[model samples]
Target: MAGRIAAVSIVEAIAADLRNRIFTGDLVSGQTLTETDVASTYEVARPTAKASIEKLVAEGLLDRGTHKTARVIELGPESVRDIYLARAYLESEVLRRLARDKAVPGDAVLANSEIAALQSGAPLDVVEPDMRFHLSLIDAVGNERISRMYRSLVGEVRMCMVRVQSLHLLDNALIHNEHQRILELIESGQGDAAAQLLDEHLGRARERLVAAMGGTAGPEAALPSTLD
Candidate 1:
Protein backbone atom coordinates (compact mmCIF):
# COMPACT_ATOMS: atom_id res chain seq x y z
CA MET A 1 0.00 0.00 0.00
CA ALA A 2 2.80 2.39 0.88
CA GLY A 3 4.62 1.59 -2.35
CA ARG A 4 1.49 2.24 -4.36
CA ILE A 5 0.94 5.56 -2.62
CA ALA A 6 4.51 6.64 -3.30
CA ALA A 7 4.19 5.69 -6.96
CA VAL A 8 1.02 7.71 -7.22
CA SER A 9 2.78 10.72 -5.79
CA ILE A 10 5.56 10.41 -8.34
CA VAL A 11 3.08 10.11 -11.14
CA GLU A 12 1.23 13.21 -9.99
CA ALA A 13 4.38 15.28 -9.88
CA ILE A 14 5.45 14.25 -13.37
CA ALA A 15 2.01 14.77 -14.75
CA ALA A 16 1.82 18.21 -13.20
CA ASP A 17 5.07 19.20 -14.83
CA LEU A 18 3.85 18.02 -18.21
CA ARG A 19 0.46 19.58 -17.70
CA ASN A 20 2.02 22.97 -16.94
CA ARG A 21 4.08 22.73 -20.09
CA ILE A 22 0.96 22.12 -22.09
CA PHE A 23 -0.87 24.97 -20.39
CA THR A 24 1.94 27.45 -20.96
CA GLY A 25 2.33 26.43 -24.61
CA ASP A 26 5.77 24.93 -24.20
CA LEU A 27 4.19 21.75 -25.46
CA VAL A 28 2.17 22.60 -28.53
CA SER A 29 -1.01 20.91 -29.56
CA GLY A 30 -0.54 17.53 -31.21
CA GLN A 31 2.88 16.99 -29.63
CA THR A 32 3.48 13.33 -28.96
CA LEU A 33 4.46 11.91 -25.55
CA THR A 34 5.92 8.54 -24.90
CA GLU A 35 6.50 6.57 -21.70
CA THR A 36 10.08 5.84 -22.64
CA ASP A 37 10.87 9.50 -23.28
CA VAL A 38 9.19 10.64 -20.10
CA ALA A 39 10.96 7.97 -18.07
CA SER A 40 14.36 8.90 -19.46
CA THR A 41 13.76 12.63 -19.11
CA TYR A 42 12.43 12.43 -15.58
CA GLU A 43 14.79 9.62 -14.57
CA VAL A 44 11.87 7.51 -13.35
CA ALA A 45 10.81 3.97 -14.13
CA ARG A 46 8.82 3.28 -17.27
CA PRO A 47 5.80 2.24 -15.23
CA THR A 48 5.92 5.53 -13.37
CA ALA A 49 6.03 7.47 -16.63
CA LYS A 50 3.20 5.38 -18.01
CA ALA A 51 1.16 6.15 -14.93
CA SER A 52 1.74 9.84 -15.39
CA ILE A 53 0.64 9.66 -19.01
CA GLU A 54 -2.48 7.81 -18.00
CA LYS A 55 -3.28 10.50 -15.48
CA LEU A 56 -2.98 13.23 -18.10
CA VAL A 57 -5.02 11.17 -20.53
CA ALA A 58 -7.81 11.03 -18.01
CA GLU A 59 -7.62 14.80 -17.59
CA GLY A 60 -8.12 15.20 -21.37
CA LEU A 61 -4.69 16.79 -21.67
CA LEU A 62 -3.37 13.80 -23.58
CA ASP A 63 -5.03 11.46 -26.03
CA ARG A 64 -3.71 7.90 -26.08
CA GLY A 65 -4.72 5.15 -28.45
CA THR A 66 -3.98 1.46 -28.68
CA HIS A 67 -0.84 1.74 -30.80
CA LYS A 68 0.13 5.42 -30.73
CA THR A 69 1.84 7.56 -28.15
CA ALA A 70 -0.27 10.12 -26.36
CA ARG A 71 -0.63 13.50 -28.10
CA VAL A 72 -1.64 16.90 -26.86
CA ILE A 73 -5.22 17.77 -27.85
CA GLU A 74 -5.55 19.69 -31.13
CA LEU A 75 -9.03 21.01 -31.70
CA GLY A 76 -10.42 22.34 -34.93
CA PRO A 77 -12.59 25.44 -35.31
CA GLU A 78 -15.88 23.56 -35.46
CA SER A 79 -15.04 21.83 -32.22
CA VAL A 80 -14.31 25.17 -30.57
CA ARG A 81 -17.63 26.55 -31.75
CA ASP A 82 -19.50 23.54 -30.38
CA ILE A 83 -17.75 23.49 -26.99
CA TYR A 84 -18.11 27.22 -26.27
CA LEU A 85 -21.77 27.06 -27.29
CA ALA A 86 -22.29 24.42 -24.63
CA ARG A 87 -20.30 26.41 -22.07
CA ALA A 88 -22.18 29.60 -22.82
CA TYR A 89 -25.50 27.80 -22.45
CA LEU A 90 -24.64 25.97 -19.23
CA GLU A 91 -22.57 28.60 -17.43
CA SER A 92 -24.91 31.48 -18.26
CA GLU A 93 -27.74 29.46 -16.69
CA VAL A 94 -25.61 28.94 -13.58
CA LEU A 95 -25.18 32.70 -13.31
CA ARG A 96 -28.85 33.31 -14.04
CA ARG A 97 -29.96 30.86 -11.38
CA LEU A 98 -27.55 32.28 -8.83
CA ALA A 99 -28.59 35.79 -9.70
CA ARG A 100 -32.28 34.96 -9.31
CA ASP A 101 -31.56 33.38 -5.92
CA LYS A 102 -29.36 36.29 -4.79
CA ALA A 103 -26.59 33.88 -3.88
CA VAL A 104 -22.97 34.97 -4.01
CA PRO A 105 -20.22 32.75 -5.30
CA GLY A 106 -17.79 31.72 -2.60
CA ASP A 107 -15.03 31.71 -5.17
CA ALA A 108 -15.92 35.08 -6.67
CA VAL A 109 -12.77 36.58 -5.25
CA LEU A 110 -10.56 34.04 -6.89
CA ALA A 111 -12.37 34.50 -10.18
CA ASN A 112 -11.82 38.23 -9.98
CA SER A 113 -8.21 37.65 -9.15
CA GLU A 114 -7.82 35.83 -12.45
CA ILE A 115 -9.15 38.80 -14.35
CA ALA A 116 -6.79 41.07 -12.46
CA ALA A 117 -3.92 38.81 -13.36
CA LEU A 118 -4.86 38.99 -16.99
CA GLN A 119 -5.17 42.75 -16.80
CA SER A 120 -1.78 43.12 -15.17
CA GLY A 121 -0.03 40.59 -17.38
CA ALA A 122 1.01 38.63 -14.33
CA PRO A 123 2.91 35.45 -14.86
CA LEU A 124 0.40 32.63 -14.59
CA ASP A 125 -0.29 29.25 -16.11
CA VAL A 126 -1.70 31.44 -18.97
CA VAL A 127 -4.91 29.46 -19.19
CA GLU A 128 -5.45 27.96 -15.73
CA PRO A 129 -7.16 30.92 -14.09
CA ASP A 130 -9.71 31.10 -16.88
CA MET A 131 -10.44 27.39 -16.52
CA ARG A 132 -10.75 27.70 -12.76
CA PHE A 133 -13.21 30.58 -13.08
CA HIS A 134 -15.55 28.70 -15.43
CA LEU A 135 -15.28 25.45 -13.50
CA SER A 136 -16.00 27.28 -10.27
CA LEU A 137 -19.27 28.52 -11.71
CA ILE A 138 -20.47 25.00 -12.46
CA ASP A 139 -19.15 23.56 -9.22
CA ALA A 140 -20.75 26.23 -7.07
CA VAL A 141 -24.21 25.26 -8.30
CA GLY A 142 -23.87 21.98 -6.31
CA ASN A 143 -25.32 19.89 -9.09
CA GLU A 144 -23.45 16.67 -9.76
CA ARG A 145 -24.75 16.21 -13.27
CA ILE A 146 -23.87 19.71 -14.46
CA SER A 147 -20.54 19.77 -12.65
CA ARG A 148 -19.54 16.41 -14.12
CA MET A 149 -20.52 17.49 -17.60
CA TYR A 150 -18.56 20.73 -17.37
CA ARG A 151 -15.52 19.02 -15.92
CA SER A 152 -15.48 16.54 -18.77
CA LEU A 153 -15.51 19.37 -21.31
CA VAL A 154 -12.74 21.45 -19.70
CA GLY A 155 -9.87 19.94 -21.67
CA GLU A 156 -11.37 21.04 -24.94
CA VAL A 157 -12.10 24.43 -23.44
CA ARG A 158 -8.48 24.73 -22.48
CA MET A 159 -7.49 24.10 -26.07
CA CYS A 160 -9.79 26.87 -27.28
CA MET A 161 -8.29 29.29 -24.76
CA VAL A 162 -4.78 28.39 -25.84
CA ARG A 163 -5.67 29.22 -29.39
CA VAL A 164 -7.30 32.46 -28.35
CA GLN A 165 -4.26 33.59 -26.43
CA SER A 166 -1.86 32.57 -29.17
CA LEU A 167 -3.85 34.48 -31.76
CA HIS A 168 -4.31 37.59 -29.59
CA LEU A 169 -7.92 37.74 -30.72
CA LEU A 170 -9.14 39.42 -27.56
CA ASP A 171 -6.81 41.53 -25.47
CA ASN A 172 -6.48 41.30 -21.69
CA ALA A 173 -8.64 44.34 -21.18
CA LEU A 174 -11.44 42.80 -23.20
CA ILE A 175 -11.41 39.57 -21.26
CA HIS A 176 -11.15 41.35 -17.92
CA ASN A 177 -13.94 43.79 -18.58
CA GLU A 178 -16.28 41.14 -19.91
CA HIS A 179 -15.79 39.13 -16.76
CA GLN A 180 -16.41 42.21 -14.68
CA ARG A 181 -19.60 42.89 -16.59
CA ILE A 182 -20.81 39.38 -15.89
CA LEU A 183 -20.16 39.78 -12.18
CA GLU A 184 -21.79 43.19 -12.06
CA LEU A 185 -24.89 41.94 -13.80
CA ILE A 186 -25.15 39.04 -11.40
CA GLU A 187 -24.72 41.36 -8.44
CA SER A 188 -27.44 43.67 -9.74
CA GLY A 189 -29.85 40.71 -9.98
CA GLN A 190 -30.35 40.98 -13.70
CA GLY A 191 -30.41 37.29 -14.48
CA ASP A 192 -31.56 37.34 -18.08
CA ALA A 193 -29.35 40.28 -18.98
CA ALA A 194 -26.35 38.61 -17.42
CA ALA A 195 -27.12 35.46 -19.34
CA GLN A 196 -27.34 37.37 -22.61
CA LEU A 197 -24.08 39.22 -22.02
CA LEU A 198 -22.38 35.98 -21.14
CA ASP A 199 -23.65 34.45 -24.33
CA GLU A 200 -22.39 37.39 -26.39
CA HIS A 201 -19.01 37.32 -24.64
CA LEU A 202 -18.43 33.66 -25.41
CA GLY A 203 -19.85 34.11 -28.87
CA ARG A 204 -17.17 36.67 -29.72
CA ALA A 205 -14.51 34.27 -28.61
CA ARG A 206 -16.04 31.47 -30.64
CA GLU A 207 -16.14 33.60 -33.78
CA ARG A 208 -12.54 34.65 -33.34
CA LEU A 209 -11.47 31.07 -32.82
CA VAL A 210 -13.31 29.92 -35.93
CA ALA A 211 -11.89 32.74 -38.03
CA ALA A 212 -8.38 32.07 -36.78
CA MET A 213 -8.78 28.46 -37.82
CA GLY A 214 -9.94 29.56 -41.30
CA GLY A 215 -13.46 28.32 -40.75
CA THR A 216 -16.88 29.80 -41.31
CA ALA A 217 -18.80 31.40 -38.46
CA GLY A 218 -21.83 29.53 -37.20
CA PRO A 219 -25.10 30.99 -35.94
CA GLU A 220 -24.05 30.69 -32.33
CA ALA A 221 -20.97 32.81 -33.04
CA ALA A 222 -22.97 35.78 -34.25
CA LEU A 223 -22.57 38.09 -31.27
CA PRO A 224 -21.26 41.59 -31.89
CA SER A 225 -19.07 42.02 -28.83
CA THR A 226 -16.25 44.40 -29.56
CA LEU A 227 -12.80 42.98 -28.89
CA ASP A 228 -10.91 46.25 -28.89
Candidate 2:
Protein backbone atom coordinates (compact mmCIF):
# COMPACT_ATOMS: atom_id res chain seq x y z
CA MET A 1 0.00 0.00 0.00
CA ALA A 2 2.78 2.39 0.94
CA GLY A 3 4.70 1.63 -2.24
CA ARG A 4 1.59 2.27 -4.34
CA ILE A 5 0.99 5.55 -2.58
CA ALA A 6 4.57 6.64 -3.16
CA ALA A 7 4.34 5.77 -6.82
CA VAL A 8 1.11 7.72 -7.20
CA SER A 9 2.79 10.74 -5.63
CA ILE A 10 5.72 10.47 -8.00
CA VAL A 11 3.36 10.21 -10.96
CA GLU A 12 1.51 13.32 -9.83
CA ALA A 13 4.76 15.28 -9.45
CA ILE A 14 6.01 14.30 -12.89
CA ALA A 15 2.62 14.94 -14.48
CA ALA A 16 2.50 18.38 -12.86
CA ASP A 17 5.90 19.28 -14.30
CA LEU A 18 4.87 18.15 -17.77
CA ARG A 19 1.54 19.95 -17.50
CA ASN A 20 3.30 23.22 -16.62
CA ARG A 21 5.74 22.72 -19.45
CA ILE A 22 2.85 22.32 -21.86
CA PHE A 23 1.13 25.41 -20.48
CA THR A 24 4.36 27.46 -20.71
CA GLY A 25 5.09 26.30 -24.26
CA ASP A 26 8.13 24.29 -23.24
CA LEU A 27 6.24 21.49 -24.93
CA VAL A 28 4.41 22.81 -27.92
CA SER A 29 1.08 21.57 -29.17
CA GLY A 30 1.21 18.24 -31.02
CA GLN A 31 4.63 17.43 -29.53
CA THR A 32 4.87 13.71 -28.93
CA LEU A 33 5.48 12.17 -25.54
CA THR A 34 6.55 8.61 -24.88
CA GLU A 35 6.92 6.55 -21.75
CA THR A 36 10.56 5.80 -22.59
CA ASP A 37 11.35 9.48 -23.13
CA VAL A 38 9.64 10.54 -19.93
CA ALA A 39 11.25 7.74 -17.92
CA SER A 40 14.74 8.59 -19.15
CA THR A 41 14.21 12.31 -18.59
CA TYR A 42 12.78 11.92 -15.09
CA GLU A 43 14.74 8.76 -14.11
CA VAL A 44 11.54 6.96 -13.27
CA ALA A 45 10.20 3.54 -14.21
CA ARG A 46 8.33 3.19 -17.48
CA PRO A 47 5.11 2.37 -15.61
CA THR A 48 5.37 5.59 -13.66
CA ALA A 49 5.98 7.61 -16.80
CA LYS A 50 3.08 5.90 -18.52
CA ALA A 51 0.79 6.72 -15.62
CA SER A 52 1.75 10.37 -15.80
CA ILE A 53 1.03 10.54 -19.50
CA GLU A 54 -2.32 8.86 -18.96
CA LYS A 55 -3.16 11.37 -16.27
CA LEU A 56 -2.53 14.27 -18.65
CA VAL A 57 -4.57 12.58 -21.34
CA ALA A 58 -7.50 12.25 -18.97
CA GLU A 59 -7.19 15.93 -18.11
CA GLY A 60 -7.54 16.81 -21.84
CA LEU A 61 -4.05 18.30 -21.89
CA LEU A 62 -2.74 15.36 -23.90
CA ASP A 63 -4.26 13.27 -26.65
CA ARG A 64 -3.61 9.57 -27.02
CA GLY A 65 -5.09 6.63 -28.92
CA THR A 66 -4.78 2.98 -28.43
CA HIS A 67 -1.23 2.01 -29.47
CA LYS A 68 -0.43 5.63 -30.28
CA THR A 69 2.02 7.89 -28.46
CA ALA A 70 0.56 10.80 -26.51
CA ARG A 71 0.90 14.35 -27.74
CA VAL A 72 0.00 17.76 -26.36
CA ILE A 73 -3.46 18.90 -27.39
CA GLU A 74 -3.78 20.99 -30.54
CA LEU A 75 -7.00 22.94 -30.64
CA GLY A 76 -8.49 23.44 -34.08
CA PRO A 77 -11.12 25.91 -35.34
CA GLU A 78 -14.25 23.95 -34.49
CA SER A 79 -13.01 23.00 -31.03
CA VAL A 80 -12.07 26.59 -30.21
CA ARG A 81 -15.41 27.90 -31.40
CA ASP A 82 -17.38 25.31 -29.47
CA ILE A 83 -15.44 25.90 -26.28
CA TYR A 84 -15.83 29.67 -26.35
CA LEU A 85 -19.52 29.39 -27.20
CA ALA A 86 -20.11 27.14 -24.25
CA ARG A 87 -18.14 29.40 -21.93
CA ALA A 88 -19.96 32.48 -23.14
CA TYR A 89 -23.35 30.87 -22.56
CA LEU A 90 -22.52 29.51 -19.12
CA GLU A 91 -20.74 32.58 -17.80
CA SER A 92 -23.26 34.96 -19.34
CA GLU A 93 -26.01 33.39 -17.27
CA VAL A 94 -23.86 33.52 -14.14
CA LEU A 95 -23.14 37.18 -14.70
CA ARG A 96 -26.83 37.87 -15.23
CA ARG A 97 -27.80 36.11 -12.00
CA LEU A 98 -25.12 37.86 -9.97
CA ALA A 99 -26.10 41.19 -11.41
CA ARG A 100 -29.79 40.66 -10.69
CA ASP A 101 -28.94 39.77 -7.10
CA LYS A 102 -26.34 42.51 -6.86
CA ALA A 103 -24.08 39.94 -5.24
CA VAL A 104 -20.42 40.34 -6.07
CA PRO A 105 -18.05 37.49 -5.39
CA GLY A 106 -15.08 38.50 -3.30
CA ASP A 107 -13.01 35.63 -4.65
CA ALA A 108 -13.52 36.92 -8.19
CA VAL A 109 -12.40 40.39 -7.09
CA LEU A 110 -9.31 38.91 -5.45
CA ALA A 111 -8.54 36.83 -8.53
CA ASN A 112 -8.77 39.91 -10.71
CA SER A 113 -6.36 41.69 -8.37
CA GLU A 114 -3.98 38.75 -8.71
CA ILE A 115 -4.32 39.03 -12.45
CA ALA A 116 -3.38 42.70 -12.23
CA ALA A 117 -0.32 41.85 -10.19
CA LEU A 118 0.84 39.24 -12.71
CA GLN A 119 0.76 41.50 -15.73
CA SER A 120 4.48 41.02 -16.33
CA GLY A 121 4.70 37.37 -15.37
CA ALA A 122 4.89 34.55 -17.88
CA PRO A 123 1.73 34.03 -19.93
CA LEU A 124 0.95 30.76 -18.21
CA ASP A 125 1.09 32.38 -14.79
CA VAL A 126 -1.97 34.47 -15.55
CA VAL A 127 -4.07 31.49 -16.61
CA GLU A 128 -4.87 30.37 -13.06
CA PRO A 129 -6.05 33.75 -11.91
CA ASP A 130 -8.10 34.09 -15.07
CA MET A 131 -9.78 30.77 -14.44
CA ARG A 132 -10.30 31.55 -10.78
CA PHE A 133 -12.13 34.74 -11.58
CA HIS A 134 -14.57 32.97 -13.89
CA LEU A 135 -15.02 30.00 -11.58
CA SER A 136 -15.74 32.29 -8.66
CA LEU A 137 -18.50 33.90 -10.63
CA ILE A 138 -20.06 30.51 -11.35
CA ASP A 139 -19.77 29.38 -7.75
CA ALA A 140 -21.33 32.58 -6.52
CA VAL A 141 -24.65 31.54 -8.02
CA GLY A 142 -24.70 28.35 -5.90
CA ASN A 143 -25.79 26.17 -8.78
CA GLU A 144 -24.08 22.79 -8.61
CA ARG A 145 -24.98 21.71 -12.13
CA ILE A 146 -23.74 24.90 -13.67
CA SER A 147 -20.57 24.72 -11.60
CA ARG A 148 -19.84 21.16 -12.77
CA MET A 149 -20.55 22.03 -16.38
CA TYR A 150 -18.17 24.98 -16.22
CA ARG A 151 -15.49 22.91 -14.50
CA SER A 152 -15.65 20.35 -17.29
CA LEU A 153 -14.68 23.00 -19.79
CA VAL A 154 -11.81 24.52 -17.78
CA GLY A 155 -9.08 22.21 -19.07
CA GLU A 156 -9.83 23.01 -22.69
CA VAL A 157 -10.24 26.67 -21.86
CA ARG A 158 -6.78 26.78 -20.31
CA MET A 159 -5.28 25.22 -23.40
CA CYS A 160 -6.99 27.85 -25.55
CA MET A 161 -5.67 30.56 -23.24
CA VAL A 162 -2.16 29.17 -23.62
CA ARG A 163 -2.50 29.59 -27.36
CA VAL A 164 -3.92 33.07 -26.94
CA GLN A 165 -0.98 34.14 -24.81
CA SER A 166 1.65 32.44 -26.96
CA LEU A 167 0.36 34.24 -30.02
CA HIS A 168 0.36 37.58 -28.14
CA LEU A 169 -3.38 37.90 -28.65
CA LEU A 170 -4.19 38.77 -25.05
CA ASP A 171 -3.36 42.00 -23.25
CA ASN A 172 -3.10 41.63 -19.47
CA ALA A 173 -4.26 45.13 -18.71
CA LEU A 174 -7.21 44.83 -21.04
CA ILE A 175 -8.22 41.56 -19.45
CA HIS A 176 -8.07 43.02 -15.96
CA ASN A 177 -10.04 46.05 -17.02
CA GLU A 178 -12.69 44.00 -18.73
CA HIS A 179 -13.10 41.75 -15.70
CA GLN A 180 -13.35 44.74 -13.37
CA ARG A 181 -15.89 46.39 -15.57
CA ILE A 182 -18.09 43.31 -15.56
CA LEU A 183 -17.94 43.19 -11.79
CA GLU A 184 -18.96 46.82 -11.58
CA LEU A 185 -21.89 46.25 -13.91
CA ILE A 186 -23.07 43.40 -11.76
CA GLU A 187 -22.80 45.49 -8.60
CA SER A 188 -24.94 48.20 -10.19
CA GLY A 189 -27.75 45.66 -10.87
CA GLN A 190 -27.56 45.83 -14.63
CA GLY A 191 -28.19 42.18 -15.39
CA ASP A 192 -28.84 42.44 -19.11
CA ALA A 193 -26.00 44.87 -19.67
CA ALA A 194 -23.63 42.79 -17.60
CA ALA A 195 -24.52 39.66 -19.56
CA GLN A 196 -24.13 41.47 -22.85
CA LEU A 197 -20.72 42.75 -21.87
CA LEU A 198 -19.68 39.31 -20.70
CA ASP A 199 -20.82 37.82 -24.01
CA GLU A 200 -18.92 40.44 -25.95
CA HIS A 201 -15.77 39.95 -23.92
CA LEU A 202 -15.83 36.19 -24.50
CA GLY A 203 -16.76 36.65 -28.16
CA ARG A 204 -13.83 38.93 -28.84
CA ALA A 205 -11.44 36.49 -27.27
CA ARG A 206 -12.95 33.60 -29.22
CA GLU A 207 -12.62 35.38 -32.51
CA ARG A 208 -9.03 36.32 -31.89
CA LEU A 209 -8.04 32.91 -30.64
CA VAL A 210 -9.76 31.17 -33.52
CA ALA A 211 -8.08 33.48 -35.99
CA ALA A 212 -4.70 32.88 -34.44
CA MET A 213 -5.25 29.15 -34.78
CA GLY A 214 -5.76 29.55 -38.55
CA GLY A 215 -9.31 28.38 -38.21
CA THR A 216 -12.45 29.11 -40.31
CA ALA A 217 -12.84 31.40 -43.30
CA GLY A 218 -13.56 34.29 -40.94
CA PRO A 219 -14.38 34.95 -37.30
CA GLU A 220 -18.06 34.97 -38.13
CA ALA A 221 -17.83 31.61 -39.83
CA ALA A 222 -17.59 29.61 -36.63
CA LEU A 223 -18.69 32.01 -33.89
CA PRO A 224 -22.29 32.83 -33.00
CA SER A 225 -23.75 36.17 -34.08
CA THR A 226 -24.12 37.27 -30.46
CA LEU A 227 -20.36 37.17 -30.09
CA ASP A 228 -19.94 39.40 -33.13
* Model 2 clashing residue pairs (backbone): none
Per-model lDDT: 0.79, 0.85
Give every collision pair in model 1: none
lDDT of 2 by residue, 62-94 (tens): 999999999998888788989999888988888
Candidate 1: residue 169 Cα off by (Å): 0.9
TM-score of 2: 0.86
lDDT of 2: 0.85
Quick one: RMSD of model 1?
A: 2.6
Q: Candidate 1: misplaced stretches above 4 Å?
A: 117-126, 218-228
Compute each candidate's TM-score over C-alphas: 0.86, 0.86
Query: Residue 184 lDDT in model 2?
Result: 92
